[model samples]
Target: MIRVVAVLALLRLAAITVAALPVQWVALRLGSSLADRLPVWWHRRALATLGVRVTPRGTPSSERPLLITANHASWLDISVIGSLGPVSFVAKSEVATWPVFGLLAKLQRCVFVDRTRRSATGRTAGELGDRLAAGDPMVLFPEGTSSPGDGVLPFRSALLGAARAAILDSGHTRVVVQPMAVVYTRIGGMPIGRADRHRVAWYGDMDLIGHLWGVCIAGGLDVEVVWGEPQIFEATTDRKALAATLETSVRDQLRAVLRP
Candidate 1:
């Protein structure tokens, strides 16, 4: 355990010291394509170092102007999902102000929304539309928060408004909304029950430092990422209905993994 934690600490220090600065400079000078790819590389390395294994079941949409709506489980979800492809996230504005994570989010070019302001969605939607049109796959956690991993929470439909904005702002007739689910299935090659899985979830009043320590010690953590069938968001599409469809797809996928 001590050796694993030491290796992880060294890996983080090396990444921040040796790789992060140069990668940031390259992404800023070149463009977002490089920015998109660098995070995937970093995330894969982090997962490798931490012994977290990810099994991605389905493909992310190849369609341009894509919005992938996923259920959130833990802070590790970012690394698990990021390792899959060149994707940016629709994160809450507060994440942009966090310590090391804030810097990482900026480097990844995540779109930050102030969820407190009801009026902000329209403006964020415009930004999301522009990003989607530009060929960036944007990930939105419609649940708007992490869950306990036992089950998914009800998705907040208001965030799905960005899909509507994509159609209107980008001049696209339709946008593809893909549903995704992330589930933690095992630790040390043994299946984790609901009671044990909560230890992997970083929610509520959990302290970030403590959770980081716990994750470092948790061995052979296995996660599954499943992408559901894509839905088209058209001008006439109902935002609430779209959100409900995504929620059901994600919930079903998660339940599949939790089942024996």
Candidate 2:
């Protein structure tokens, strides 16, 4: 019965993706505002179809040239956050090569960063800065990799350089770096224990197809998204210190939601 439900859910998801792909592509080509909005609708519908409920706390900052720093836990983080508003992501370059998902990411205007090559970091930072300068909200998963939904990995300060870059490029006094957290708290309307986390969190060498199927079969996922106070990043702000502060904010929020 679970397998049947998973199959049905997967078919619905595939249909949604197929239906949106062409419209999003055209919107992007024509530079329409729909390009910024369709993803939100799509994600919300996807979440609904999969029986994932998102509880957003706090508010996303309204400031221009904003960069949101969040902890990574699973692939569903994209949909959970995307459903909130129009925002692009800063993802690893490898994601651009992923089948189907890569195309979807491109449509969402994600900035692909090649983390393996130190030389590419500067270029990617500049691109991110340009996007932020244009008043585009960019979501950065500073943890660099997804965790098991139990803890946050240490955030890398390198990409935080984009904040400084945005300040310079836009001639803005400061850029707002908002800390956000995505926590998977429950499944099937019950609190999730450590052992059940694997069913929701996708990390390490887990196969994407299998994990996705598991999530579809299990369904009834509850995620909490907490937005922390926005920190102003000025020319003199220390990137490493800022990264550490954001990391702490996210970790604290995760603990509050997961343990409370």
Q: Per-residue error at 38 for model 1, in Å?
A: 1.0
lDDT value, residue 105 of candidate 2: 98
lDDT of 1 by residue, 67-186 (tens): 899898798999999999989999989989988788888878899989899899888877888888887889998888887886889888876776576557667888889999999999
Per-residue lDDT of model 2, residues 101-189, tens digit only: 99999999999999889999888988888899899999999999999989999999988975577558767878899999999999988
> Best candidate, TM-score-wise?
2
Candidate 1, residue 189: Cα displacement in angstroms equals: 2.1
Worst 10 residues of 1 by lDDT: 13-22
For candidate 1, the lDDT comes to 0.83
In angstroms, give how far residue 101 of model 1 lies from its true place. 0.6
- Displacement of residue 49 (Cα, Å) in model 1 is 1.0
Q: For model 2, what is the C-alpha lDDT against the true structure?
A: 0.92
